[model samples]
Target: SALNLQLMSLTLFDVFGAALGVFVVLTVCKFVEEELSNINMPEMKGKEGRFQYTITDVKITELNLTHADLQFIPEVGLLFDVQNSSITLSFHRRILYWFFYDTGNINASAEGVNINTILNLIRDDDGRLKINNITCDARIDKMKAQFSGTLGRVYDFLASFLTSGMRFLLNQRICPALNHAALVHVNSMLETIPVRTEVDQYIGIDYSLIDDPVVTSRSLDMNFRGMFFDLSHQNDTLVNYAVDPVIREYDRMVYLALSEFFFDSGMFSYFTAGIFQMDIVNEKMPKDLEMLLRTTYFGAIMMLNPALVEAPLSLQLAVNSPPKTSIKTSGATVVMTAIVKVMVLPPGQPPVQLSSMTMVYTHIHTSFFYFFRILLDFFDSNIFKIFSNQSALESLALIPLQAPLKTMLQMSVVPLINNWTKRGVQIPLADGMDFIEEVVEYHNGFIVIGANLHFSKGLREMISVMPPPHMAVYVEPTEALPYDSDITD
Candidate 1:
């Protein structure tokens, strides 16, 4: 029975080992599930007085580098070990126990290992985990000098590599995902409005004098008389007649249309109007002897009585007068030559008027590099040095190692939200131009269809109390309209 007792003891040890292994696996599974499940996405209300469902709880756990524990290995002169390798990143709160409980059932077969093994499995050849060699002088005097110089180069190279990788991953992947999520959120909010039709109308009226033969002759005579005598009163009368009620009506219509759109859409945004040409043209009068009589008489009298006239007038008269009657006739014919012309009244159709309204949605996101830089700076300080004597080297190497993980985690939520945007949602309230052009322009220079809002101080304050990310609606005429048939119908 002694041999049987020893065998029983060995069997008990095996059972205990198996139980411990199970516990570790269960813990890892639970953590992974919780990290993946707890994401926070914002909810938005539509114009139809309905709510649009978005992923307020967006959890990114798979590649989260923040969960990793760093370690410095002086033997290899490289920081390669990470502990508690699992991390849970989410936009919202999560129930850790429940997630792990279910995960345990699914992944019961695979055994869980230490954090270092997990990281090493995923580490690249040139990654921070790679072994590094350090050479130092045998003499104790030179040991410090050699160690500092060789390790310094290693540290600098590692830092540069990590910084570049982090920047590259964020710019290429994480930023795009964030951009897509924003676009989806905007589009979902836009779908709550009921109307999707874009209407733009232009109206213009022009007025001018009807240049008939009689009117031309009279106008020419008036001009000639005005030159000889003051004609301010006559000029005023001409101006009043040329500008008609019809032109005033055109201007009024334009103003009314703009006002109505603004009032109906509840948009008090400022707009600017510009005019290219506001001009007047009169017909030319046919040759008239009466109109030229003043000029001819003045010329002849000045020439005949040079002693009674000023020197300038005498010279003008001498220059103007001809020697023979035939020559005088020719000169008068040339001077009095005038062609009768009719005024073109803009074809009795309205002139083309162009008006534009710009609607902007100002949304600011934290810079991609800002958060990374903050993390980098924080780790560089002496405070972080207490965590590891060789923290500088570890920090530099870990920077690049964490880049891909950061990028992967940051962008992980994008595809899911993007799909929701493309599916299209409908809003139920009577919508205006603001509802039609649901365009969401991303901060990174991309745009998608969504409702745009320009809010006032009061409205913005009201929205601030509500949960983020809020939407603002602006109404302005645009070429694009929403694809939803219910709103358009």
Candidate 2:
């Protein structure tokens, strides 16, 4: 009986404790709900009349409230504890209010006012705004108003700093490297030379001939002299005689001899035969040669003219002349003698028989010689040494600068701006606190980097609506009211 009584008492005590706990929970929940209701109710008569309220915290038990109650609770805050709660009804009301009330009035009154004007009006004096723009209906306005004051300025500043840094890095490093690569490729192409070749056929001959002696035995001698020769043989008589005719005749013979010697030795004859052969072989050859010679000869001429070679016919005639000689014989014995002569032809002016040939050869040779001379001078001069040193210095400068610049641009500048822009972030006002923490982070502290970015599409849209700097605006803030009626009536 004692054991049963003790067990029954323990059970009753446990049941009472459970009941007390439930009562306390219910009382606390009621108090919290009442407090939230009062805080969320707007004062329609005061200066805060235009302001709305949002609830950030509530117990999970109150999630089943109607749409009217949910309007004052932020969707994120409402769903904090409650699962499967309907937050869509509250969001739709907020969007509807934004379109009908705020947007409609701004559009009707400000004829020329665009999205930018609204943005500017709402922005703080320092150009910072916590909630840039709202896009919800009346039910969600309470949540939107919670962000209205100036709490989001910090995030905006952070995003702007990162974006500016990104742009700076790209300009400093990436652009230069790309430009250098292109320049290097162009220089390499310019330094190379294309190759070409030409072939030509040259023919030459050497000949020797021996003469047979057949008419050596049949020879006779005869002598004759002028009758005036004995009188002219006296020294005084010969001195008195006029010798101008003989002198003139002797000069003519000497001139003839010189001409014959040049022709036989293949000097003038070689040049003449070349022109004749070129004219016969191909009409084009002479014209082309003439044009080349003219161009080259317009400059300076050189010493050696390689183009003037003896023709085959001229060579044959020269060889034949050596063997066949005219001889005067007295009786059976024969007198023999041989005379040999050589002729030289130097490069000359135009209109000369071999002018084109000489000029062409001289010009080509001179150009080659000039080029070699310049090359030698370059190696010998101080300028060449300076150029070599400068080239080395330039390469050294470029190599070190290139890597750092590329790193800063791609890792910091480009990523910061591009990522933030992609995420729809806005530029913060210049209030001296643009640098935000953890906006950008790097891995290996060297190669790869990461960034956190936020973007404002509304801000971008507003900026686009504004006209360029050249345009001016005319407005009067103190204009008289159109309605004179008193509202108290």
Question: Candidate 2: lDDT over CA atoms?
Answer: 0.19
Counting clashing residue pairs in each candidate, in order, gives 27, 19
The best candidate by lDDT is 1
Error of 2 at 334 (Å): 48
Global fold similarity of model 1 (TM-score): 0.15
lDDT, candidate 1, 1-489, per-residue tens: 111110000000111123332332343334333322333223211121121211123334343222322222222221212233332222211112222211110000101112221111111121111111222111000001011222233233222222222222222233223222223322333333222121111111111112211111101100000000012121111111110111111111010001111111111010001111112122121123212311343334334544423322100001111111011111110011111111112233433211111111111222111211100000010111111123354334333323332232123322322232122222222122113222222221211112222222222223233344335332222222121223210
TM-score of candidate 2 versus the correct structure, residues matched by position: 0.13
lDDT of 2 by residue, 1-489 (tens): 111110000000111123332332333233323322222211111111232222222122222212111111212111001112121111001112222321110000001101100100121222111122222211111111111222333223222222222222222222232222222321222122111111011111111001111111111111101001111111111111111110111111010001111111111122222211212112222343323333342112222443332211010001111111111121011111111111122335222122111100000010101211110000010110001122454334334333332333233333432331122111112111111111111111011111111222222232334343222232212312212223111
How far out, in Å, is residue 242 in model 2? Answer: 52
- Per-candidate TM equals 0.15, 0.13
